[model samples]
Target: MARNTIRKDENTTRRSKKELILRLSVYLKPYKKESAIVIGLMLFVMLCSVLNPYLLEIAIDDKVANHDVMGLLEIGGVLLVLNLVAWAVSIIRWKKIYSINNNILLNIRRELYTHIQDLSFDFFDSRPVGKILARVVGDVNALKNLFNQSIQLLIPQLLNLALLSIAMLMLNVKLALVCIALLPILAIAMFCIEIFSRRRWEIYRKKRSNLNAFTHEEFSGVKVVQSFAKEKDTNDEFKHFVKNLKKSWNSAVRLNDMFWPLVELSAGIATVIVFSVGYKLVISGEIAIGTLIAFSMYAGMFWRPIMNLSSFYNTLVTNLSAADRIFDILDVKPDIKDAEDAEKMDKINGKVEFKNVGFAYEEGADVLRDVNFNVEPGERVALVGATGAGKSTIVSLLSRFYDVTSGEILVDGKDIRKVKLESFRNQMGIMLQDTFLFSTTIMENIRYGRLDATDEEVIAAAKAVDAHEFIIKLEKGYDTEVNERGSRLSLGQRQLVSFARALLANPRILILDEATSNIDTQTERLVQRGIEKLLQGRTSFVIAHRLSTIRDCDKIMVVEGGRIIESGNHDELITKRKAYYGLYSAQYEFLNEGA
Candidate 1:
């Protein structure tokens, strides 16, 4: 397997702050009714807060200092009732916000996953799984926090500030003027912090993603590392990734920490200025003592939401980078998509044809050039070649995992590219050298081949592949749990399960890529019987490593340097004494030496 270089530069995808918000809000459209209700509740909640200071003003002026006991009690009762209503509304509002936030997260993650599934093999070839995982997991999680703040915090805070401003100005223009003057300074400070913090966060996220990629890669291939005794080397590489993450994490945290204090300092300064002026006005009788107290209370209300807004701004700036990374993946249009006029291939007869096919993994570097071949329905064809000689590429093209750079692939005499991808792929079954099984019961793993398959049908498929005996022998039988990647099962057992899965699909065309390479000779004999029956009446392409396995192929093509150098039956090829002869002779000699 080739290790692809990680392109660090691709992580720094940037979008304008305005565009990011607008794009995210698109998810909010589906739940507009809930959003509206939440916003309305926030408005009423702002009214409740704004009314408190004015009520205090009246309570102090006309009841407390006036020594009217009943009036004071009445005011207290009103305040209590108001606070109760505000609290209740807040609880309901947040409940709704939480629901909306989770739904949006679910939708975004689903969309990302679906898009990734549709992408061509080349996309996966170019990027590591960890990089993609970061976007799907960590990045999506960050967006959830932003959504929560946008509804439950940002919108309400802005309304609170606005309503508080109006109430303050009506009560006393002088105090209100002084309080509002600090707004511009707070805004400037926030702007400056946001600019600096955004860059730090972007770097931090990239480092975090890099760390995740490295960890996933190492753990996934742990066996290889242990076999080569490269644990120390791998640990060193891990430390290198962690050190980079720590530096970026520290830098981002340091910048983020500075934000709260600046916001609090601005609020603190506003408080001092308001009180210094309000106290003198009260002493001079220009404003009543109650009015002075009310102004101070209103000033607190005003600055509190400013602090909230500042917090929201900080969150927004940091998460904006995450949003950009997510959109980068969503923006990748799949290179292979059904054409506008593509037809649905309902029932394929599986006559495969490659007409002047040419392909390349990269430009000007052809992997297969002008490759031409044809397989009539029910023909069993064997593709033989050295490593990287393009045997696998041929199967990939036939399955339309990739499109030919030049020429066409036809199924049932119609160009496959002109057929709907899903319909075309549904009729094909592919078994690779490495078979992947999900963490689930053996029954479910086999049923994955055809989701609609019945339990008996699943067991029947397993039986067809000679997997039933071992499966039934297990303590749990078909219900036995296969751990991740079917790690608990032997490699041969895993391959058998895969064969059962592919067989259950019952595809019109079958592709076997070194499928029997892992089985022991005894097991191989049993599997071969099953395979022969499975291959009957289907167009099959087999890539075989063992020369003997392909002896029964109707036609054998000797692939060399990305072209079909020769084609004949096994006996005819051995007699020709060319490339196939060389391969057969080497294998025969090896088997004889072992004997």
Candidate 2:
């Protein structure tokens, strides 16, 4: 497979941030009651905050200036009460916001996972597991701050700014005008910075995704890296990815950092102007000292929200790329889906046919061309070929992993594509060269073939593939817990368990592609005996590298570059002395030489 690092579809029609934000608002609808309560609490908090500075003006200009100590004490007591109430409400708001964030993110990740499961193998073929993990995990996590800080503050911040401006203006309009003088200029500057910062943040996200992909792929294949003594090469590549991420991080952070300082400096200069001018007004008695002080403080309050809004906007810009990446995966339509009116397949007898079927992973690069074959009900057929030949591709087409680029496949004379995927796939069992086992007990692993199967049924499947003995020998027997991918098990043991899994499914049509290649000669013979009995009544396809494993197969087809060059029973192919004959001879001699 090619190294497919690009996760986003370049051809996808880009959506404006407005559209994305509006779509995100839909999630809020479900939590409207909680959201409304949070908003109400924030409003009360804002009211309490803004009223204090006004009360300060009242106490100073009315009570303190008139020598009324009792009135000043009452005002101070009211201020204390308001602060206590605000603090208590603020705690509740924080708790509610956290709950909302978790629930919304849960919903998004659930939808993403469900959508991905329905997508075709073609979607996975071009993207590494690491890149997919990055979007699902890291990218989703990046939206947390957006929800907590940005969304929670959005309405509150605007309202806060409005209240502060009104209070400042009511105190003294001259100072208010001077304090807001630079806002228009700040807005223009923000617009310009955002345009450039948005692009840099996107680059930063892509670089992080690339690093994730490279790291995951190397770790997955770490065994190969060490076996081939490529650790130095791999470490060098790792360093390159790290350095690229570092550079991208610096570029994106430098631009984003400019916002906070810029907002602060502008507000600082405005405050200086307000106070300097207001000092003259107080002395001239155009405004009292208390009013001038209150107005200047309110001016400060007004810009604090502006600073917060700037911070919120910056958060949006930073995570917008993450949202785009997430939506990109969701936007991909499954390549292989049942027709709209498709229905469940009829009970299968496992009579299968490939009628001039041709397939390509890429356009005009056919992997299987004009492939034609049929397996009669209850027949056992083996496919043999060198690496890169169309042997596995043919079976993959039969299983509907990828639709044929040309021609069609029929199961029981019904088009597979016209049948619902779940209904069709349920009747077929497929075991690939690499068997993947989840981190669970061995019993649970076998029972995955049929979730409702009894312990007896699972054990029977294991006994059928001769996996029962080794399974019992484990410290935990059938309940033995396996690590991820069953790494604790030997290759041959894992293969045997995989065979048992396929057998437990009791599929009408079974395909085993290089399933027994990892087993030893003795174990293969034992497995062969059990498989022979099981193969008596089901149409099955087997692909193997060892020629001896398939000698008993009813027929053998020798596949070459996207075509079947020879087909016959084992003895008949040997007599013909063609492609199958040569392949068998070479393998036979190699086995003897090894002995």
Candidate 3:
């Protein structure tokens, strides 16, 4: 089983790498015009490199040895012109390729970012925010060198090698054959190096991602760590991740550094061989002095490109793993999305229905199984249950955040799956348990509910929810700035601000998922009055821990073990003396004792 699992993992990695390469090619397609110009410039540069040596041969044998000072000067001028042209071409080629590479990187980052946003909540639920950020910010940036080196180093080096090889063959065939013989040995060495280096770099990338995930999670919960006095424990844990990250980085860099030395050593040996063999040829009168000299230069030129190409290949191997990680996210299909040919829903009447709807995050452990319920239009319903009893899951399904694993949910007699998501969700508003506020003015945050809402309309919504009083008391009133997640405001204030935002959305169906849990009992009374006015004409699903809060609800459903066991108005349920009776009795006694 373990071996099979290993084989499966290897196959997956291979497939993903192939897919990533194909995707990268698609991104490169748009820059073909620029690429063509770069390649043309490089070809010119390659010609100059070979021509300079040939010009040297001419200056030495024909011009100087023949004692023609005028001819030597003329050839020297031509040589200078050729080198200048090559230098200018190099500059143009680099500028063109850099622009192309930056654009490609930008496209990759944007597409990955957009794809992440389209992904469903379950995608986020399974992965930490840090790991996702690492892919977006760190992993995407890591590929910059891979793309830059591929064009700037790999292509030019290969072109130079080819031109140098041809020049060597034309000048002296025997030495060219010697250069050829040594190349295979170098190629074999590089191939071996690549195989070992790739896996080590992959391990290094994974370790870095792990460290990032831990850092983000720890710092985000720093208050909890301090409250529990677990600072020493967290510090020790952080050190452990740091130690592992350093070890993996060292392992990867050690192997990657081997490519340069191996290539240099091979180049040195090849140069020595050319001198040894070429001397005998020149002494035997088989080749001219100019030809031997130029051929020797060609041999040296050939190896430098080979070394550069080898380095580029190593860079590619290292960053391909990062590219693979990025493609992994881009490949995930969103779990919740409107069906093809789905129609836009009309204004929602707020009649919600669940018919035998079943859902599970995993395959077997059902959070809600065979759950069925319906709410009338403009009714106020409260879902009361212990933690993890699937109360929130029901509301989430209603909001279409997660599709049911089986059966269906309907809004106004139409299956929600058959309606376009934006149209369906536009008419609904949800105030989550954990209130999140962007770093912006409180007025803008509330305006986020309805971007087209006028300032007066926003104020009206705030007044309806009794949030305006608190807003006006702040230094800047509704214009007061709030930090991310509303950490600047007290918990109850944050909830009130969130409440006002939801009110501003003016949703026909509103869900308050423990929206009042943060408010103190005194504040709760004031907020409760606002809640009463807020629920007037809208169909609302209120999930509350405090039973007193739901006593006035039109219908109350007691959920247990993923099913509704008892349901009725508060008075009717109290008369039954069943699950609802037991719950209310327990809560009433607890509250009295606390009082």
Of 1 and 3, the candidate ahead on lDDT is: 1
Off by over 4 Å in 1: 1-10
Candidate 1's residue-wise lDDT over 1-595, tens digit each? 1334443534456899999999999999999899889999989888888888898899889888879999989989999999999999999998999999999999999999999999888789877899889999999999987898888778778778888888899889999998888788778877888888899889988888888888898899999999999999989988988888899889988988887888788878888899998988888889998888888899988888888887788889889899999998899888899999999997988798899999987544888988988899999999998988999999999989988899999999999999999999999999999889999999999999999999999999899989999999988999999989999899899999999999999999999999888888988988987898789889999999898899999999988888989899999999999999999999899999999
In model 3, the worst 10-residue window by lDDT is 1-10
Q: For residues 1-595, write the lDDT of model 2, one tens digit per residue.
A: 2337633322223468898898777777888899889989999999999998899999999999899999999999999999999999999999999999899999989999999999988788778788888889998999888887754789889989888888887878888889989999998888888888878877887888888888888888888999999999989888988888899899999999989988998999998899899999988889988888788678878888998899889998888888888888888898889899898997799898889988888645778888888889988899999998989889898888888899999999998999998999998989888999999999999999999999999999999989999999999999999898999899999988988888888889989899888888888877986687567688999999988888888889989999988888999999999898889889878878999
Candidate 3 lDDT over 1-595, as tens digits, reads 0111100121115344456667777888888889878988988988888888899998898888889999999998998899998999899988998999999999999999999998998778766677778789999999898888767776678778878888888888889998888788888988888788778877777777777888898888988999999999999888988888899899999988988898888888888888899999989999888888888788878887887788778887788778778877887899888799899999988898999999888545988889888899999999999999999999999999989999999999999999999999999999988999999999999999999999999999889888889889999998899977788899998988888888888899999999888899888877877788778899999999988898989999999988888889999999999999999999999989999
Report the C-alpha displacement of residue 549, candidate 3, in angstroms: 2.2
Worst 10 residues of 2 by lDDT: 5-14
Q: Sorted on TM-score, highest at the top, how do the candidates line up? A: 1, 2, 3
**lDDT (C-alpha) at residue 448 in model 3:** 94
Assess each prediction's global lDDT (C-alpha) against the native.
0.89, 0.87, 0.86
List of clashing residue pairs for candidate 3: none
Off by over 4 Å in 3: 1-12, 16-19, 475-479
- How many clashes (backbone atoms < 3 Å, residues ≥3 apart in a chain or on different chains) does model 1 have? 0
Pairs clashing within candidate 2: none
**Candidate 3 overall lDDT versus native:** 0.86
